[model samples]
Target: MLKNKNLIMIFREIKVGELVDFVNTVFYKNANIVPITPQRAISQANNPYAQPNDVALVLALNNKEEIIGFIGILPGKTMLTDERFFWNTCWWIDPEKGKIAAMPLFYSMLKITKSNLIFFDLTPHTASIVAKMGFMTNSITGTKVFLRFNLNQILPKKYAFLAILKPILKFFDSCLNTMFAKKSAKKELNYQVIKCFDASMEVFLSKFKPTMLTPFDNTFFTWISNYSWLTTQPNEFETAIAKKYYFSYITQSFVVELLKITHQNEFIGIVVVTCRDSEMKIPYCFFDDNATEKVLEAIFNYAYNKKITTITTFHPKIKEQLKLKKNTVLFTKQLVKHVGYPKQFETLGITNKLFQDGEGDAVFT
Candidate 1:
């Protein structure tokens, strides 16, 4: 169909000044890009590490430019601290011009940079088209359930039982694992993880009041709390109040995770992900760059001590900051993934697999 079209589709980079305007015009008819705070947007553009990508365009190969389709592409893992590389409204094209005419411009975009995946977030319209372009659909069993490991919340109040009931619990776990492997017994099985609450977390939430947070809320809370000078105040009460509100927002938005950290103190800086159970058939755990090779050691230690099977959640590796680190209890970065097993997606019922972004839009990134 594009062969018959005469319009010469030319792709080019968008000027920083016009990025917001272009994003608005492109997604206006579909989803929204209006909620991103102006302050956050500017910070990204000014960051030294921010990867460059197309932000706007002068429609058609024209000089006196007017944008018809606006798109933003961001570098994966590495990005400007404040700037978000959007899977923006790249599909924005004039309907009258026809899909055949518009698609070439979209095709031209891959030349700018490669993305791990192009999310057909709003328009399922492009799914078939993009998939045909070589993007493989993930298997239904490949989906994951996001379990937030709230450092202070959801901890089992009864660690004493694990000691006294060790033998009985071990037998129970063995039976449950055996049954869980058989598809026939899977329907009636439930495996609850060991949980331990952080007293500091409980105290902090009580003193402060902030916005509700998702699993990603921990980092964002730290970021947004900087918005006000409250964090710098000398009064512990004032600071605690602000943080309390922030923590409350988190509990309301995301589910608590099922694990406990190796160390419960904050005297040092070591960030690690601990695992206690798996909602899916497999165990899942993640670590940041700072965790270094020590995280592996910690995981092995924990698994050995507990006598449990474990699997590490795969993420692009980063610096290991958790070394002085004994397996410290708090996590500093947001680890995201598709929800549920891929079977749910294959059956076309992957609703719970979706998540709302920090800014309030349901995004699949």
Candidate 2:
């Protein structure tokens, strides 16, 4: 329980071990407001790198025992510091019902993490708030290149009146795509889809790990690839639970896959492709600097074959190469992704470039 200016709020810190049971038993039935979904909670519980006692979520409840505020944490080990740090995944407070609890919820998280927290993919409002709390806000440049016209899927979400025009928009897409057919033609590339890492892949990554900002290992990637927060398929119970959850618990389709790309019968690059509905993101990609062009060509081919609408990437070389291949895509938008870290990280010499596009909990989502 916490008291702020005579306002009393009950806060519950859910540790890693308790996440699954808490969501399944208490949260499922009384989930008018939810901190995490059942599948996500299970995935967090199954994380091999996380400790059992690490606090994963903090919830604020009022006198009526209704959850009004929450902050989610994903425990991680920073390679540069070799110390424990928490990734701030999700934080929410109902504007009308939990306005007063917002600060308190943040304070609770700070106390639990002892200020060792990393925040990324922030909205403008959230970036402003975190800046005031002594966090250094930094940004990474990325691009979302549209391979196929998806105005029918994209515009309707922002302008409801356009929903009726979807048929026409789709018709336009069909005609335009037919005209640009040769540009998107799929090329055969030697690639292997693996559920888990093999010995050869582990050896290849070991050489590159030391130079990486986070230096995640095979075990970490295995956990990430196997236990995903989002799903392409959901059962009836999961569908029912999603209605009460605020975050992305369900989607039209979702899949995370590891692609081992080879050229001339030799391995060239490895990438993690995350597909949600029509969009695709290369969360984690590793390749030799010289192989950037080939790797991108492989990615474009994969996107074409999969019918991905757009591809988002933050790798500097990949983004630069995309600029050269502008004709291959319908359009491209520059994106600035903001990230926040405790000010103390400055003393550790951490910089904006140290982070990948898939930093924080972004890969899982």
Candidate 3:
């Protein structure tokens, strides 16, 4: 730890092996702020791509020894180039308390990684901040198709006072859904949702290696599924940590599953889906290009039966398919997500890279 001006102390590169101890000792239990939740810390410690000396996090603490700024780094490997990269998982700075520490925290990370970092889901403020840091920004188009009216959950997010009107909103939503109900001819499709991947799934993924940008294999998927960052069940310690943590730590319902899709007794594809609350996102989907219609039909049927509010995806092919099936959903909206990578990667053909919807830390939550 090094102390600087304004009496702030910086922990430059907290290694993966030390994450558990730092989260347990110097975090919420000892200070007023929590840098990382216990579950996330565990996931970081066991990250398959992380090495013992890899910098897992950078932290800034105030005079009171409370963490005021932090930037999490998850190590990654570029499958095609065989190069290592760091994904900026979460970057937060206390608005009222740590305004001055933001630059320090970010600078610390840049120094440690030498600008070999990639980040996504940038807010307007974060976008501007990163753009000024010599990082190149790119955009990917996604779609959020709503299959159900979710005003009860959506309204309160922007207007907190509407939280008390949940019962009325829920009633309105139910009435709208009933009005939009449909009965259509059934299609023949088979799928199995499993919590973990088996050897058969690994064999399925091996054939698509050339298309993947990240080094995603059975070990990587197993690490992700077994150690999800968001938990539906929170213990006392976790509950307390959630109150202070800046990022997602707990949810009403969270599930990550592997879907083995089969059509007509033949294996079609495998998909990784994460449903948090009523929203579902397809993080990774691998299927025969010609079988797009059948795979999408399977996904639509699953969402309809589960009463999922919306389905989101950034896959270009999937987005195009969703456009053709507008009648299957209540509504659809186009979304653009921003990604940041070091300007240095540009010389190495970064622009032509193919990124998955769940690349970096986008899927873990």
**Local accuracy by lDDT, each model:** 0.33, 0.83, 0.81
In model 2, the runs with Cα more than 4 Å from the true position are 3-7, 160-169, 181-186
Residue-level lDDT tens digits of model 1 in 237-341: 333333422111111121223333233242111222323332111122333334335444444343334333322332223213322333332223333332211
Error of 3 at 204 (Å): 3.4
Q: Taking the tens digit of each residue's C-alpha lDDT, what string does model 3 give over 1-365?
A: 55656575656568899888877674448666676777888998898888988988887876676777888888888764656788888888888887777887788888877788888788877877899988898888999998889899999989999999999999999899789844332555477787666788779888887777786777878887878889798898788878887788888888777888888878888888888888999999988788888888878777776778899999888888888988877788999998888776678676766678889888888
**Residue 73 lDDT, candidate 2, scale 0-100:** 90
TM-score of each: 0.32, 0.92, 0.91
Model 3 global lDDT (CA atoms, 0 to 1):
0.81
**Best-to-worst ranking by lDDT:** 2, 3, 1
- What does candidate 2's lDDT look like per residue over 1-365, in tens digits? 87767567898889999988887775547767878877788889987758999999988888778888989998877766867788899999988778878888888888888998889899988989899999999888999998877778888889999999999988987787777633554457667677888888888887776556675666878777777788668898788777878888777777888889888888988888998887999988888989998889888888877888899999888999999988778788999988889887878767633577777788877
lDDT of 2 at 283: 86
lDDT of model 2 at position 264? 89
Model 1 alpha-carbon drift over 4 Å, by segment: 1-8, 15-49, 52-65, 78-89, 98-101, 120-122, 138-365
Clashing residue pairs found in predicted model 3: none
lDDT of candidate 1 vs native? 0.33
Q: Give the distance in Å from residue 253's predicted Cα in candidate 1 to where it truly belongs.
A: 17
Window of ten residues with lowest summed lDDT in model 1: 246-255
Which candidate comes out best when scored by lDDT? 2
